[model samples]
Target: MTIKLLAIGKTDHTDLQSLIDDYQKRLGFYVKFEFEIIPDLKKTKNLSEDQQKQKEGELILGKLNSTDVMIVLDENGKQLDSVNFSQYLQKHMNSGIKQLVFVIGGPYGFSPEVYQKANGKLSLSKMTFSHQMIRLFMIEQLYRGFTILKNEPYHHR
Candidate 1:
């Protein structure tokens, strides 16, 4: 299955963007992976938190295809270890899915409509992380999961 990571805004930090690119390149060896950044919303000063979320939700939803499996990355979502995450990937691949999309929401988190569209939710960690940082972390974890699945030395047990 092809894996797509949809995140709100760009990673402005040079260091983080470099790492994200590295992982994306590495993941290419294992599977088709796409890292897409939805441009940040402007004029947020006049919009309420819910309003921002609603707008972001629309953009997120527009990126998805009807047949795609959408999973939102939320702090309150189910937490899984590296091994289990690999198994999760394996399960999806075995199911003959064409595309699996994982989304990282904007600052206020996903709107109710976005949640309704999601097939599931996953939490990378209990502690809060900047959206930029989470982009790197998520990609690295995906690379690690693929390595673990292949018994590569890149990931040590």
Candidate 2:
């Protein structure tokens, strides 16, 4: 299955962007991985939190194909270790799905509609992280997962 990461807004920090690019390039070697950023909503100071989530939900939903499986990277989601995450990916690939899309929501989190659309949710950690920082962490974890699958030297026991 093709893997795609959809996140709200750009990574403005050059350091984070560089690391994202590097891991993305390495990830491509193991699978068809795509990293996409959805533009952040503007003038959020005027909009209520719910309103912002609704708008962001629409944009997030717009990026999805009907056949795609959307898994949100959420704090309350089921947490997996590196090894299990790799097997989880293998299970999806074996199922012959066309695309697997993982989404990182805005700071306020998902709207009801977006939650309805998701096939599942995954948590990297129970601890909270900045939405921007999560982007980098997600990418790196993906890379490490692939390496673990291949018995590569990147991640030590």
The most accurate candidate by lDDT is 1
Cα shift from native, residue 19, model 2 (Å): 0.7
User: What residue pairs are clashing in model 1?
Assistant: none
Error of 1 at 71 (Å): 0.6
Question: Candidate 2's residue-wise lDDT over 1-157, tens digit each?
Answer: 7999999999999988898899899999999999999999999999999999999999999999999999999888999998899899888989999999999999899999999999999999989988888988998898898898899998895
Tens-digit lDDT string for candidate 1 (1-157): 8999999999899988999999999999999999999999999999999999999999999999999999999999999999999999999999999999999999999999999999999999999999999998999999999999999988785
Compared with the true structure, all predictions reach lDDT values of 0.95, 0.93
Candidate 1's TM-score: 0.98
Cα lDDT for residue 78, model 1? Answer: 96
Q: Model 1, which residues run further than 4 Å from truth?
A: none
- Top TM-score prediction, candidate number: 1
- The residue-level lDDT of candidate 1 at 25 comes to 97
